[model samples]
Target: MEQKAAAKAKAPKRSQFSGMSKALVRRETISAYLFLLPSLFFFVGFVVVPMFICLIYSFFNMGLDSTSTTFAGLSNYVRMFQDPVFIRGFWNTVLIVVVSVPAVTAFSLWVSSAIYQMKPAVRSFFRCVFYLPVVTGSVAVTVVWKWMFNPYNGLLNQMFNTVGFDWLGNTKTAIWCIIMILFTTSIGQPIVLYVAALGNVDQSLVEAAQVDGATKLQVFWKIKWPQIMPTTLYILIITTINSFQCFALIQLLTSGGPSNSTSTIMYYIFYMVYRYNDFGYANAMGVVLAIIIAIFSAIQFKVTKTDN
Candidate 1:
């Protein structure tokens, strides 16, 4: 009887402890949810829900004044393959990446090396100068470049004509002008990134190499280059991404050019959305673009991956 009485008392005590633990766990869960609530709400509202909508839209022919969606099941993708304009846009974008990424990487690396080796104030001023295009108003920069590219009496054409080369006036030279503008203007971000990577490198190691009679070039090649390889890889990835987003400059400067030479994937997407009333196709293109970005990013991660 006494043992049974103790067992009954223990049962109630254990139940009370378990109930308190459950309540405490419930409180912790609620707190965690509370902390994440705003971000979660925004993600769903702005990103997740729209992403689903886009995915579904991609499978249908959703258009303005035609809320009715027709099942197309890869026809849009099929159309994309058949689209000469889209193909040209794709090649143009790829061409920009092929030419601009390397040039931008090289120039930004040079600028970063020079600036990093200078006095702090001088470094700041030059870095600021490079980034001025990005900061000192994007619209004004676009406007200036547009005027510089005018076919009749632009600065570029005038200079080229002076040199007996009508660059802006010639079809072969016009796309290249677009590429140059993109590369030059977007140098800011890469330079900043390179400078950051350069700052993190061990100065003592570099100096030790110099003390060992290593040439400046040797020191940079041996010690500095390997260290900043990650930065180079990073810039490559970002440059590719930004090259596509350079549609703003295209829209402002070329408007897809004298013969659609400057129409990028993003620019095409914009035209589809605004001009063609083709929301489904635009959404499909968006999904494709997103996939391309994700693939490139994954490739970058693989290429730049550290053993650890």
Candidate 2:
């Protein structure tokens, strides 16, 4: 009877402390949300509001400067299918993605692998060199490239006088020129990421594989590849999106020129908005671009998951 009475006395004390802990947890949660409220307000005001506006405006025919609007229904979306320029732009965008993604991923991997084992000074130097193109603003890079690609007096043509190739003027070479520049800019971040990922790979596993007489290639493929898959997936998705949104280079370099041969979806969107003043059509194009990017990202995640 004494033991039972003592147990009941302790139970009440425990319950009292538990209730206090619950109240404290609630207070901390409320404080955290309060801290987040300002940033959330700005995010909603700038990003969310604009996205909703774009969605709503995409259903109506609107002009850049005019106050009037007409309900467009699906006409803007329907017209995109019939637009020859949009089709060509889409195909060009696809070509850019197809060519750039693998090239960027592979080249970055190779460079990162090479530099990852070097002395710290050497690795840092190479990293900075490869990343220079990215930090130098896109406008500046494109301008320098423009100067280099000049057919008459550009440095590239000066060296290849006999071949006499018009790097940016010829339709066959214009897109590739853009790709080459895009590549220089794209690999910088991937290299940094890859170096980080490679550095974090468990040394014990690599040492074990070596002790087992595994070749360097075998060790990398077996032990390292799976660990770095997440970083690889991230690189792939970002590279794809960057390739899709390749606008400044096209705008400053070719302007979708030589019969729209180099036009991309982004370039076409700009053309529709500024050149044609079709706000609704441009918004529809923007929406479509977002959807396409989402689809591509989904497919990449699915394929990577299956491979894993």
Candidate 3:
């Protein structure tokens, strides 16, 4: 009877401890949710809400002024496909991405690899120099580029002694000029990321490759490159996205001028919203741009995963 009584007492204590553990877990879960509440609120309020609003607005013929909405039912999307300006803008955007993504990735890789082994101070100086354009606001950088590319009394014209050809005015050269500026701003972060990735590569593997009489190129390609593939993929996606959204420089410098040669979807969207007050059409373009970006990003992710 005494042994039975002792066993019953121990069982109750075990149940009490388990109950306490569950209660503690519940409390911790609630605390974690409370900590996340603020950020969740802002994100849902600002980003999620605005995105849904844009999506809904795309389906209607909405104007800037209130109460002018009518059900568009994909008319805006239909018009977008039919619009010649949008077509030109899309092509221009494609060209920018095609030209810039590879250049930025390759150049940043070269810069990072070259400087990763240098003295800390020297490496930092080079990084700062490359990153300066990014810290300098886009508007400021665009303005400076504008002055440099000016036809008369501009540094570039004076240096080349070609006064008649306007760099930003000529359709053939305006896109190139925009690409150059885009290149400067786009490279900074990628270089930083590459440098960090290179730093984290396994030194022992690199040393072993070198000791085996492997060439520097062989060592890098065989050992280092695979490790940094993630960084490269990240840079590719971001650079592609940024190139597609190449608006500020276009707006500040060319204003998509010289027969819309420098026009991009972003610039076209801004033009529609403010100049034409075609809110529904603008939103439709936005939805399309978002979809395109998502598709490109998905492709990149799939390629990276397959490579890995």
- lDDT of model number 2: 0.91
lDDT of 3: 0.92
Q: 168-278 in candidate 1: lDDT tens per residue?
A: 446577679778877768899898899989999999999899999999899988998888887888888888788767786778777776577878888899999899789
Per-candidate Cα lDDT values, in order, are: 0.82, 0.91, 0.92
| Ten residues in sequence with the least summed lDDT for candidate 3 | 14-23
Residue pairs in steric clash, candidate 3? none
lDDT of 2 by residue, 1-308 (tens): 34776999999777754646777878888998999999999999999999997888888999966578999999989999999999999999999999999999999999998999999999999999999999997899999999899877689988877345678888898999999999999999999999989999999999999999999999989999988988999999999999899999999999998789899999999998888899999999889999999999999989987786
Count of backbone clashes for each model?
0, 0, 0
TM-score of each: 0.83, 0.91, 0.92
Per-residue lDDT over 134-244 for candidate 3, one digit per residue giving the tens place of the 0 to 100 score: 999799999998998888968998899898669998999999999999999999999999999999999999999999999999999999999899899899999888888
State which candidate has the highest TM-score.
3
Range of the 10 consecutive residues with the lowest summed lDDT in candidate 2: 14-23
Once fitted onto the true fold, the runs of candidate 3 whose alpha carbons sit more than 4 angstroms away are 1-20
RMSD of 1: 10.7
Best first by TM-score, ranked: 3, 2, 1
